[model samples]
Target: MIRITFPDGSVREYEAGVTGFQIAESISPALARSVVSCGVNGETVELNRPIEADARIALYKFDDEQGKHTFWHTSAHLLAEALQELYPGIQFGFGPAVENGFFYDVLLPNGEMIKEGDFKKIEDKMIELARKNEVVVRQEISKADCLAQFGAAGQTYKCEHIEQDLADGSITTYTQGNFTDLCKGPHLVSTGDIKAIKLTAIAGAFWRGDATKDQMQRLYGISFPKKKMLDEYLLMLEEAKKRDHRKIGKEMELFMFSERVGKGLPIWLPKGTDLRIRLQDMLRKIQKTFGYQEVITPHIGSKNLYVTSGHYAHYGKDSFQPIHTPEEDEEYMLKPMNCPHHCEVFAWKPRSYKDLPFRCAEFGTVYRYEKSGELHGFTRVRSFTQDDAHIFCRQDQVKDEFLRVLSIIQTVFTIFGFGEDQVEFQISLRDPEDKEKYIGSDEVWASAEQAIIDACKEKGIKARCELGEAAFYGPKLDCMVKDAIGRRWQLGTIQVDYNLPERFNLEYTAEDNSKRRPVMIHRAPFGSLERFTAVLIEHTAGHFPLWLAPEQVAILPISEKYNSYALEVANYFDTVGVRATVDNRNEKIGRKIRDNELKRVPYMVIVGEKEAAEGTVAMRQQGGGDQAVMPKEAFAERILGEVAEMLKATNLKPEN
Candidate 1:
């Protein structure tokens, strides 16, 4: 018998060679039935794989992330099986689970084509194969044998992948029915578990995401354990289509992309630019209240700057090629990160312990080279500005600074009306054994990591811990927020770093007259203006709050006859700091209201004959309702009052 450790710190005796399924069965039959995968000593693996020694184990149900990944992974194999049956000589490349679904890249035989119309037939065939309940078998094979199997089967793509990527003893193959592919899998027990299947899309993709490689058909799909669940998922997908920022951005005339300028660069229109500025001003006011000093940095830096900061080693290849200067040795790179530049600012002058905590903030625009395929409207743009700040403080001040940053994030979320459930807190730490992946000494990394964890604990914040998810320099406190449609997006982050100061040789004189390195805190409540705007647009469905709306009020005249009165109301609103526009277009009163409503203006005022005569304005809310006629002065006060209250309610006062 060997000792088995469970997550709850309970130990039990189990016979050697007992499978994870058997161990789960010993706990409860229900668990055995629901478990799709198991974590053995921190590694996720197939449930039926035998455990020869004592190990820490956690059984995973379909609701768990690992379990869902396992389920979708098996579904990918199931897709390949269906493809093999329907289209003979179909060669498969990479097939892996994605964020919402799974996709398999494949090269079709000569004269064969797969289109959107073929999705139904393919889904039907997948369901048929799933009903077979075929057991998925995993096998370890030598590289020679692996290449031989795929080569003999005329799966050139598979053969090429194995030849190029797999090592001799590291080859593994998973077989379900007649379909066998090279994979290292923690798959579900059988295809029977996949009850509902969807073939969502078919697109062209290059093998291994290489533009130089042959283009293949990428089939995207998703699966669920129950039909009702699949139905709900499909409904969510439909809702997502409606909220897609690209569609809404164009419809609202917020921003656009151009082939003449560049593919991934976004050009913000007048309305979008105005809205972004409002957001920046709000953040600026909050930062000022918290004693943050604002600064500006250049858009490009010497390649050596990144090299010293260690960003070059990690992101250099993915970044745009360096720009050569008049001198051959002098080269510059588009700023991929702001931290390195901030490091330079810290090093420019000598400092004493009195100047220990330096808080510098910037709305710095940076550039990155994102693959064309990965670029989406504003979310994944190549050029964007980060509401970035770097706090250089003494070691003891790390926790307090971190808590202050978290407070800022909470304040912003509250102002945006995000409830606790709509946002998740996570502490991302480095993998303990992977020293090569991160900078800093073990002691420094440990201290920085613990500071973040301890800070969260002290603040009564419950955060999930993710290992091996840290930045190359430090651990992070990340906020993953869900939009109105319940789609999660990583929005804000605060990272603790002890490495950069050491690399830059930044020093501040201590009371003992000894030089000490200052700890760095990197934070961004709005990671990027463009990406946050995209998320906010989707979350509110373009109905911006009164304070943040680009055009808060639309003054709609009954006709050309009341255009003068409309201008009068607009002027009154302008004096009270209300952003209002007069719609004196050649259109009817009803048509004007309808058109302005689609613009998502928070409020609309109708200055008609009665209002113009009475010196009052009729107020209408964006979605609906006539909110009574009020004096023009009274309407301005109402708008101004509501905005002031919103800011007051959400502002965070720094702790003394």
Candidate 2:
């Protein structure tokens, strides 16, 4: 008998070689039926895998993320089987489960092609295969045998993958019916478990993700055990399409992209620029209250700067190629990060313990060379501004500084109406086995990691820890916010670093009169101005808050006759620090209102003969029905009052 420990710390004696499925059965019939996978010790494994020694186990159900991943991974194999049946001689590449679904990359034989129109046929074939309920069999194979089998079958992609990527002693494959593929799987027991499937989209992806390699057709799809769940997922996807920021940004004329300017570089139009400036001002004010000193840095830095900071070692390949100087052998790179420049700033001035926690902030625009296929509107642009700040402090001050950064993130989220439940914190730590890849001594890494964990504990913040997710120089805390459509986007980040200071040889005279390295904390409440705005555009569906709205109010004249009164109303709003515009074109009131509403202006104030004579304005809230008419001053004051209340609640006392 061996000891098995449950997550709750309860231990039980079990016979050696007992499978996880048996353990689940021992717990309860309901649990056994619901469990899709199990965690043996810390690794996720199939329920059918036998355990022969003492272990810690956690059974996973559909509600758990790991279980969902396992389900989707099996769905990918099922998809491949369906495709092979429908299209013979279909060579396959990697087909892994993604955040939402699964995608299979394939190379069709005889010049065959797959497109969106073929989704229905593939979906039908998948359902037919799923109903057969074929059991998935897992097998461990020798690298040589795996390559030989795939090569004989004319699967050059599989043969290449096995021969190059797989070690001789570490190779596995899964077979379901006549379809077999190389995989490291914790798959569901049978294909029939996938009751519903929907093929989402088809795109071109490079084989092995190398741009120079042959491009394969990638098909994206999702599966569910129930038809109703699939329907709901489809509905959410439809809603997502409607709320796509790219479509809304173009329709509202907020931002644009020019091929002549660049592919991934976004150009802020007049309205977008106005909105962006407002957001920057808001963040600037917030940072001032937190004692962050604003600074500016050059857009280009010497390649040696990044090399010393350890960023070039990690991001150099993907970044824009170095620019050679006209003079001697000097090369500069477009800045990929602001931390390196900030490190230089910290090193510029010697300090005592009194200057321990110096904070510097910048709206720094950085450039990186992302693959052309990966670029998306404003969200994934190559050139973007980071709402960046770095804090240089003593080791003892690390926890307090992290708490303050957390407070800033919480405050920003609250002001934006995101609740605690709508956001998640992820603590990313370095990989222990890959020590050479990361900077800093083990002692410093431990202290920084512990400080973050303790800080979150003290704040009562629930977070998940992810290994191998840290920056090359340090551990990090990331904030992911889920939008209205249930799509999660990374919005903020905080990193603790002991490596940069060491690299730069930055130090401060301690209270004991000894030189000590000051720990660096890198944070950004809004990860990037461009990406945040894109998320905001999608989350609110372009209906920005009154304080941040590009145009808070639109003064719509009932007719050209009341244009003067409309201008007066607009001027009044301007004086009150409210953005407003007058629509005096020859258009009907209904048309003007509709147009402004589509623009997502928060309020529409109409002026006509009666309003002009009475010196009042008619109001209609965006998405809200017509509000009662009121004096122009009363309306402006009401809007200002609401903004003040929100700011006050958030404790955002931006510096004048």
Candidate 3:
């Protein structure tokens, strides 16, 4: 008999070679029907895979992320099969599951081609194949035999992929009906399990993501077990497309990119600059209250700086090349990170224990050489500003400092209207077996890891732990947030580093009169201003919160006749610190309102003959409809009150 331990810590004795499906059936019929995959020990595997030894297992259903990944992986295979049937002699490349769905890269035979219009036919063929309910069979074969089979079948792509990527001892293939593909998989039992399918788009991609390789057709798709779920997914996708930040940014004239200026470099228009400054001012105030001392750092640093910090070894080749001095051997680089400069700052002054836990903050703009193909608008940019801070604290103070940082993150999220369920915290720790890769001693690493774990527990943060995900220097706590469209984006990060201090030989005089290294905590509440702004734009659909809006209120005149009244109202708003603009163009009131609404201004204040005579404005709130009419003074007071409330809610301190 073999013992299997379940996630709930319950153990059951079973015969050797008992399959996960059989085990699920013994527990409950519902579990047997719903469980799509199982995690044996720590690795996810098919539910049908037989267990031969004592192990721990967790059954996963469609609701779990892992289960969804397995389901989509199988869906990709089914897609490949349908493509082969639709276009005979199509050679296949990689087809892996993505965060939302799956995609397949293939080379069509001869002169055959695929376009967006071809999606329906392929989707229909996939549905037909799925209805057959053919079982997906997995087989392990020798490298020689696998090569021979694909070579005979004239699948040069598959043959090249196997020869170049797969080792002789680790080779497997999955066959379903008349289609077979090389894969390392945990697929669903059969094709019939995929009840619904949607082929989203087709694009050109380089083979295996190598620019020098042959370009292949990339097909994107999604699948679900029920038609209703597929419908809901499509609906969400539609909403997402409408909320795409790139589109909204263009429509609102907040930011733009010029091919002449360069790709991936975002140019902040006047309105976007106003909004960014406001965001920075808000963060500056918050950091002040949190006992952070703000400082400025250069956009570029000496190349040797990164060499000592270990960034050059990791990102050197991929980063922009160094700039050499005219007559000196010295070279400088556009700073890819702000931590190394901050490290130099700490080492500048000798410190005592009383001066421990020194927090340095900076809104530092850094540059990196992101590949042109990987560039997106604002989100993946070549240059961006980081709301960065580093805390140099005594070893015993790590937990307390982490808790304080956690509070800052929580405050920022709450101010932005992100709820508890909309965000998740990930605790990343170093890999134990490869201690040499990290800088800190085992004792310091253990202390830092435990401190972070305990701090999360004390703060009531329900975080998931991931090993081998830590920064090479230390452990970290990463904040992953879901935007309005349900897409997850990594926003904030807090990393505990014992490595930098050691490398820099940083020390503070302890009470015992001994010099000891202070642990460093690297944190960024807004990971990068560029990326955060992009996410914020998408999340709110360009209707920003009143305090963050570039133009919180637009004074729209009824016509040219009421332009003076509109200017008066705008002046009043400006006096009260509300970002307000007057729309005095020679157009109808309706046209002005529609234009401002399209610009996503939060409030629309209308001034006409009636309002002008009475010295009042008709207020229209975005998405909230009309608010009550009020006199200019009353309106300014109301706006100020709302702004105060927002700042209070965000725990933003007054700028010092």
Candidate 4:
């Protein structure tokens, strides 16, 4: 017997060759029925894969993210199997499960193409195969044998991939029914688990994402264990379209991208700028309370700066080429990160232990050479400003500083209506097996990873650990918030680094007057202003909170005579720090109300004969229902009071 530890810290004695499915069966039949996959010592694996030694295990159901990944991974194989039968000689490129669902790239035989009308046929075929309850079999094969099999089958892409990418010992494949594909997978036990299927879309993708390679037809699809779940997902997709930030941004005149100006560069209009500035101001106020000193950094930096920080080695290809100079042969590039520049700032001064915790914040704009095909609205822009900050502190101070950052993140999320239940934390650690993908010594990396774990434990925060997802330099705590529609978005990050100080040779005098390197804490409550704004737009559906709304109130005139009173009410609101706009257009009050409602203004005040003479206004709330008549002064005070309450900050200081 071997000891198998469960996630709840319970250990059970089991036979050495017990499979995950057998282990689940031992616990409960219901659990065995629902469990789609299991994690063995942090590695997700097939349920039937035997555990030959003592291991830590966690069972996953379809509702769990890991379980969904395993489910969709098998569905991708199922898709390939269906396509293989439907379109003989169709060569496959790559098929993988993504955050939403799965997609497979394939070159159809004889220049054939698949279109929207073909989606149903393909989906029906997938369902037909899924009903067979075919068990997926994972096999390890030699590279030569893999190449021979795929090559014999006329799959040039798979052969080429095997020749160029796969090593002899590491090649693996998953076979289900009539189809087999090159894959490394943790798949569902059987195809019958997939009760519902949908082929979402078809797009063209260059083989391996290289623009120069042959473009193949990419089929996007999603599968669910329950038919009802697929129906709900379809409904969510419709709601997502309605809440799309790009569409709402245009209607609200928030932000836009101009083709002539270049793609992936968002230009904030007046309203967007207003909202962004307010967001900055709000963070600045909270930052000030935490003793943070804000700084401004340039948009370009010397190439050597990044080389010294090791960012060039890790992300050079993702950044624009270095800009050459006419004189001195010096090379500069658009800033891809703010940490290196901030490192220079830390090195600028000699410090003692009293000044160990040096915190600097910047709303620094950075650029990346994102592939044109990968760019999305503000969420995936090429140029964006990060609310970045770095804290240099002693080893003992790391936990305190981390908790403080957590407090700020929690405060910000709460103010934006994200509750504790809606937010989840992830501890991203470097992969132990793949050391070359990261920097720093194993000892330092281990310490940094443990610090985050201990901090979260002390704070009583439950965070899921994900291997190989850390920053190249260190481990990080990432915050993902579920939106109103239950879609998770990564918005905040806090990283602990011991490598940068050593790289930059930064030092501070300790209590014994000895030189010591201070630890570095990198954090961004709002990962980037652009991405956060996009999420906010979708989360609130363009109906922003009064405190953050660019135009909190729209003052409409009933007629030409009341236009003056509209402006008067606007002026009064401005004095009281309320964002009020006068809609003194030639259109009637009904049209004006309709337009402002579409803009999602929180309040609308109608200025007519009685209001102009009585110094009062008739008020109507957005989406109707809340109607009242109040003096302009009373309305201003009410708006201001509500905003003040909403803007209230959480406790800035937490116990160490």
User: Which numbered prediction scores highest in lDDT against the true structure?
Assistant: 4
Off by over 4 Å in 2: 1-13, 653-656
TM-score of 3: 0.92
lDDT by residue for model 1 (282-374), tens = 898889988899889999999999999999998887788789998677999999999999988888999899997899999999899888888
Name the regions of candidate 1 deviating beyond 4 angstroms. Answer: 1-13, 52-54, 432-435, 652-656
Worst 10 residues of 3 by lDDT: 647-656
Candidate 4 per-residue lDDT over residues 1-656, each given as its tens digit:
99999988999999899999999999999999999999999999999999999999999999898999999999999999999999988999999999999999998988999999988989999999999999889999998899899989989999999999998999898988978889999898789999999999888999988999999999999999999999999999999999999999998999999999998989999999999998888898899989999999899999999999999999999998899997989999999999999999999989899997999999999999998878999999899999999999999999999999999998899989899999999999998999999989999998899999999999899999999899999999999999999999999999999999999999999999999999999999999999999999999999898878889999999999998889888887877688889988899888999999889999999989999999999999999968999999998888877776665554322110
lDDT by residue (530-603, candidate 3, tens digit) is 99999999999998888788888889888888888888888777776778999888888888888888899988
Name the best candidate (by TM-score): 4
Clash number for each model: 0, 0, 0, 0
lDDT per residue, candidate 2, 1-656, as tens digits?
99999977899899999888899999899999888888887677888888999998888887677788888999999899989998889999999988888999998998889988899989998999899998889999998899888988889899989878889988999999889989999898778768899998899999988989999999999998889989998898898888889999987789999999989999999989988898888877778888999999999999999998888888998899899987778999999999989988988978899997999999999999988888998889899999999999988889999999999899889889889889999999988878988988899899989999999999999887777789988899999999998888999999999889999898999999999989999999999999999999989988787777777788999888899889988887887777788989898888888888888888888889999999999988888766879999999888788777767877754221
Off by over 4 Å in 3: 1-16, 140-142, 324-326, 430-447, 653-656
lDDT of each: 0.88, 0.89, 0.88, 0.92
Q: Which 10-residue span in candidate 2 carries the lowest summed lDDT?
A: 647-656
Which pairs of residues collide in candidate 2?
none
